[model samples]
Target: MLSLRVPLAVALLALGRARVVAQTTVKTVDLGYATYQTDASIVDGVTSFLGIRFAAPPTGDQRFRAPQPPATIYGIQNATVQPDECMQSAVGNATTPFRLSKRTAFVQNEDCLFINVHVPADLDLTSNASLPVIAWIHGGGYAGGSNGQNPAQTLVSNSNNTVISVQMQYRLGPFGFLAGETVAKDGVLNAGLLDQQFALQWVQDHISKFGGDPSQVTIYGESAGAGSVLQHIVAHGGNTQPPLFRAAMMDSPFLPFQYEYNDPMNEVIFANLSQMVGCPISNASLDCLRSVNASELNQMGQVIALDNLFGVFTFVPVVDGDLIVERPTVTLRKNQTNSDVTLIMTNSHEGDVFVDAAALVATNSTLAEYVANLFPRMNDSSIQQAVALYSNLTDVSAPTVPEQAAFVMGDSIFVCPAFYTLDAFPADSNWKGEFAIPPGTHGSELAYLFADAVPGLTFNNSAFISSFQSGFFSTAIALNPNTHGADDLKPDWPTFKQTGKTMLFNETTTGEPEVMTIPTSDALLERCAFWLSLSDVNAQ
Candidate 1:
C-alpha cells in the first residue's frame, strides 16, 4: 500500500479541474440497483464510472462482519466522486518518508466499499464483444491504503483504449484484520480479504454491463495487495476451479506466516487493543469492540507501529483455517493455486522504503535488542546464532551491520518467499519473476505507469514503459490474444521453469529501459534456504 503522498511540489499539477463541456457525449451504465453517469477523460479517450458500490457498508451491526452486496438502488445514482478511504490513522509528516510543505487531505470513513471503472472509448461499444479487464488492488501493508490514491484513468489512457481497469476500496487496519479467540469465535479474521473476494465476485457478475469480459479478468496488486492475490490463488485449499481471475501479477508480495487466533503473540495483540478500548476480556470482548466509536478504534490501532526487525504489521490477515485454509506455501506446494499463469516482480531496494541509516545505527549499537525484536520466541542461543548469521562482519555483500540487517529483512519477508512461492507451483505451471534494478524503489514504477497521478513527474522509461507494460498486460490477459506469440518486436519473456532465468528491468544512464536475462543467482538460493528454515518465526 502506498503511504507516500503526492509531494507538495506537484500539488498544483494535481489540482487542475476536469473540463466538462456541453458538447461532450454523456454515457450512462445501469447496474441492477443504480444507474451511473460516465465521465470522459477528454485527453485520454477513456470513459469512467467512479464510486460504484460493490458491497454494503460494513457499518452499524454489520461492522466487523463479512461484507454483503448493497441492496437495490432507488434511482439514478451519480458516481462522480469515489468513496472515502477506509478508516486509518493520520499519516502525519512526522511519520511520512518525504518532507512535504502541504498536508494531504486525509479523509476516511466506514461507508467505503466501492469500485471505480475505466473503459477505453475506442473499443467496439456497439457490439457485445467484451474487453479484457485488469482489477487493481492497492497496497498499504493491509493496514492503510485506498483505491482512490492511484486512479485507473492514467493506466487506461496509456493502454490506448485497449484495456479496461477497475480499482476497489475495502476495510483497513483493525476493522479489517483483528483476530483473537473471542473475535474469531464470533467473527472472521481477514475481513478485508473477504471484502476483496466479494469485489471479484461483483466483477464476475456485473463487468459485462460496462463492456468488460468477466471470463478475462486479471487480478493484480502491489505490496500487501500482492499478498492478497497470492492468498486468493491458494484460497479454500486451492481445489476450487473456474477461478474469478484467469491470471494474476503480484508486485512485491510480502508473505509472513499467517497466525492462528489462539497463538500467544496473536492473542496479545487483540487482547491489548481490546483492553485499551475499554472492552472486557471475556467472550463479550468482540461485542464490546463493536460498540466503540469507529474513530476511537482507528486511533487505538496506531499504538501498534511497524516492528523494528521484521516490519511486522500489528493487525494483518491471519490463518483462520477457512478462507485461508493452510499456509500459503503449503497450499502452493500442493498445486492448489488457481490462476493459469502468474507473474511476480520485485525491486532491488525494497528495503530502502522501510530501512534507513537510523535503523542501521540503532542495530549496530544494540544488537541484542534488534535480535529480540525480530525473534521474540527464540532462545538466547538461537538469538545469538541469528545475530551472527545476519551480522555484517560475516557477510561481505552488505559490509555494514545496518545494510546486512536490511538485506536479511527484505529477503526473508519479501524476495526469497517470492522465490519459494514461484517454485511451489506445479512443475508445469507458467510463472516468472522479474527484478527491477536500482532507482526502482517500492512502488516507484507507478510514477512511470501513471504519470497523470503526479503531474510533471517523469522516469527514464516514461516514454516507452507504458506501452511495454500495456503490451505485457495484453499478452497476459489475452486482450490481443491472437498477437501474443506472433508479436516479434516484443521481448521473449522466458518462463522460470526452463532455465531459472529472470528478466532484469535495468534503468540505464540513457532515458530508456534495458531488459536483460540472467541466471538465477546462487547467493539468493543460499539466502532463501536460510529464511525458509525459519518460515514459522512469528514475524508479528
Candidate 2:
C-alpha cells in the first residue's frame, strides 16, 4: 500500500519585482513524504526552490555515516530561504582572496544536506516539458563551500526556459571526508562523495516532478566540485550501472594527493582528530568521536588541517578500495570513466592562489622543496625530474622560482587533470578550453559565468559573458558546445580529440573579447605527460 503525507492549506505566493506583494499563486510539488512551496520572486523569469532536504540530519550517532533519506514531513515546508551552509574552516586568515570567508559567512550546521532547484518560470509541470537538467556541486577543496555561492538563476534564464538547474549541499571538512581503517569498518569512507551520489539519485527520483528530463542530466562543477565530478566518473571503476549523469562539465578540476584509505598519513590525521576531540584512538574511536559535539569536532578538523604546511587542505577525498578502486590516474589511464560527453576547462594560472607567496619570498624555497612539501610521498627520482622540468622555466609567465613553483602546482593539480580527462573520454565526445583572461587566476572564469551572483568579481564584458554562457548552455541543452544560441558571437568550438585544439577565452589588448580556437601546446602536453608518469610516487 502507498502512503502519502499531503500538506494542509498549502498557499504558495508568487511575488513581483518588489517581492513584498503577492503577484500570483505559485506551484507545489509533492515528494511522497513532503510538499515544498517554491519562491518565484528572486529572479525575473526563474523560480527557485531552495533548502529542500534530501537527507536526514547527520548528527549524533548518524555522524560519519552515509546519508540516509529524509524522514517524513507532515506539512508544506517553505523552501524559499537558503539553508545553513555546511560548517567551514580556513587556515588562519589567508583565504580572504579566494572569497572563502565571504561564502561561508552565513550560519552553518550539521543538518545541512539540502538541495536547491531553479527552473524556468513558465515551464509546464503537467505536460512533459522534460527540460535538460544541470546539477551543480559546490567546490571548497572538499572542506568548505556552500551551494548558495553560485546561483543558477542566470543559467536558467539564459537557457530560454529550456533547462533546469539544481545545486546540492553536502558534508565538508572532517564530517564528510574522515577516513581510516576504523572509519572504513564502522562508518562509510568518503561520506561526502556518497552524499553527492545520493543527491544525484534524488534528482533521478524527483526532478521529473518539476518537469526535468532525468535522462538528460548533466553534472557540472568547478575546482573541488569538478574534482568530485571526476571522482564520480571513475566511481566503482566506472562500472556504475545506469550512470548517475549523462554529461559532465569540469572547470579547473583539482586533483590533490589521493592517499589510500588506511595510509599512514590518514591514520595520523584520524589519530590527531580523535585526540583533539578527547577520544582515544582505538576500535571505539569512531563512536567516541561521534559522541563529541559537532562544533568541537569541526574546530579540531580545521586545526589539524591548518597544522599541515601552507597551500593544502588536510581533509580531502581518499582512494577508498570500493568507491574509488584506485588512483584516479590509474582509472583514467585505463579508460574506466562513466560519463559519455565531457567539457573541461582550466585557468592559465591555477596555482597562483595556492602557493604561499610570503614563504616563497622569505625562505626562497627551491622548486624541489616546494614539490616535496606538496607531495611528501614523491620519490627522489621524481622530485629531481620535476625540478629539472620547472627550475629553468624561461617562459615570461613563470620566470622566477616562485612563479615556477606556481606553474608546477597548477600543472600537476589542475591542468594535467583536464588533459587526462580529455584523453580518457572518447575524443569526439569531449571538448577542451582554456580561460586565459588577464591574470587567469584560479576561479576567474567563474565571474564570467555567475557575474551577478559571485561577489568581488569585476568582469562586465557583455560579449564574453554571452559567449561563455552560450557555450555552457548549448552543451547542457544539446550535448555540443558548438550549437550555441544565435546571439552568441563565439566561433564553432572544436573537439579536443579532432585536432588537439583548445578554445581559448581571452580578451584583446583593448579589452574586447578575443575568443578563438588554437592547437593545444605540445610543450604543455609534454609537461603534463611527465607529471602523469609520476602519479604513483605523487600518490595521485
Candidate 3:
C-alpha cells in the first residue's frame, strides 16, 4: 500500500482534493480568488499556473468594448488545464508550417481573455523574493494567435528558476482591431492593445502573490507582439500614465501601414464586414455587429485577410487620436515615444517568413510585380533601381528569385524601419537593436527561446545559438533589457546610442558561441533613404 501511493501532488489531484492549503494554493487579492495547484511539477522545480482570468469575458453587450476587471470568484478554482484560446479561424493547410498548424486546435470561444503565469515552485511569495517578471505577448500578425499556443514552462526552466513569466491572450482579428467611426464613438479604438494594457494592470495588482515584483515588470513581444510593445511605448503620446512596465524588448517589431483615423479604406473594410454578417448600416450599427455570431465574424475576417496579397491586413490597429495618436513613424520622428523605457529591439531574417513561407516569387517578373503591389508609390524607374539593389545582393550559394526577394522584403519591411525608429530616440536614451544571423527568419528566435526548435525546420539553429539567444532574455529579466545583462555574458553588447553599435547574436557550430560587433546595416540603407524621402503616396 505504501509503495502504491503515487507522487503526492498527483495522488491528491487524482483523489479530487480541493482544499486551499498554504503549500498547494495561490491566492489573488481580487476579492480573495484562489487558484489550485497542478501536477506539472517538473524536476527543475517549476510550477505552472494555467488559465487565470485577467479580465471579464468579453461577451454579449461587453463585446467590442474595453476589457473590464474579471469578476471575483470565491474558493479555490482549478488552474491546471489550459483555457480556450480566443476564437480564430482555422489556419494553414497541409502545406502550412508545422509551427503554425500545432496552434490551431486550442482556439475555442469569445470568452478567451485569459493569462498564464509560470513561477518557480520554491518561490516564497511571503518573503522578499521580488523576482523580475517578463510579460510576453505572442506574434500572429494581430489577426490570429492565442496565449495557449506558447507555454512558459520551457522558458521558466531555461531561466533556471531565476525569473517569473506571464503571457496573456487578447482579442484577435475583427474582434480586436475592427476600427471605424461607428465602433470608436461607442467604445475604444484598438481594443486588442487595451486588452494587453488591462492584463498588465492585473499583473501589477497580483504578480506579487507569485513572488514577482510589479515595479520590475518588463514587457516583451515578437513580430506583431513586438509591434504591440513598441505601440505601448508610444501609446497616449508616450505618457504611460500610472506606468505599466519599466522596460521593453521587441523582436522583429514590424510596423505595417496604418491609416490616420477613419481613412475611407478603414470604413470601407468595416462596412464590408458588416454587410457580410448582415449587420445593416444604421445608428445602431455597432449593436448590429454585436448580435452576429462569433464564428461568423471570425470567418468573414479570415476571408478578407486571405484575399489580400500585399502586407495590408484586413484588421489592424490604426492611428486613432485617443489610443494611438499618429502614425508610429511620425511619432518616432518627433521623439514622442516614452523616454522612461530602456529598450532592446531586434530582427532575424525578418522577411524570410513573410516572403519565403508565402512562396511569393519564382522569376524577376513576379518579384517586380510583388514589389510594385506592395509599394505603389514607386514608379517603373524606382522599382527597377530597387530590383538592381536586391539582385546584386543575392547569396551566391543559393541564388533564387524568391530568396533574393526575401532579402529585399527583410530590408523594406523589417530592417529599414528599425533604423528609422531608433533615430527617433534621444541620443542619450538607453536603447539597443540588432540583427541575428544563420538565416534568422521572422519568428525564428522564438523557436530557441521557447525550446520548441524542431529539427530540419528552416529556423532551427545550433544548441549554442539557442542557449546564447536564451541568455539575452534571462539577462534582461535579471537586470534590465537595456543592459542586456553581464559584462562577460557574451562580449560587450553596447547600447544603440553609444557609437551607434548593435551586437550580432551568431554561432558557428552547435557548440561554439560567437559574439561579434557590427554597425546596424539595413543592407540597402540608400534604397530605404530614397523610399523615406517620398511624401505619403496612396500605396493602395
Per-residue CA lDDT of candidate 2, range 367-425, in tens?
A: 88888877887788888988888876644357677889888889999999999988888
Clashing pairs in 1: 1-139, 1-140, 33-73
Give all candidate RMSDs, comma-separated: 5.2, 4.4, 6.0
C-alpha lDDT score of every prediction, in listed order: 0.67, 0.81, 0.66
TM-score pick, better of 1 and 3: 1
Off by over 4 Å in 2: 1-25, 91-104, 394-396, 456-459
**What would the C-alpha RMSD of candidate 3 be, to one decimal place?**
6.0
Tens digits of lDDT, candidate 1, 1-540: 122322111211112233341112455777877776654443357766666889988887788899997888776665554456788632222222443232135556778888988877555444676877889988877777776666566667766666688988878888898887777777777899999999999899988888888988888888888888888888888754557987777778877557776678678877778888998787644678888898888777765533213355666778888888767777766766777777777767665555554644744544555556555676777667656666733323566665666665577667776777677665444445454545556676565556556442445445345434643465455623124334322355556666687766665676566666667776667767766666566431
| Count of backbone collisions within predicted model 3 | 2
Give candidate 1 regions above 4 Å deviation.
1-24, 40-43, 89-104, 123-126, 306-310, 366-371, 378-397, 426-429, 433-437, 451-458, 462-471, 479-490, 509-512
As for lDDT, the candidate ahead, 2 or 3, is: 2
What lDDT does model 1 reach?
0.67
Candidate 1 C-alpha RMSD relative to the actual structure: 5.2
Evaluated against the true structure, the overall lDDT of model 2 is 0.81
In order of appearance, the predictions have TM-scores of 0.87, 0.93, 0.84
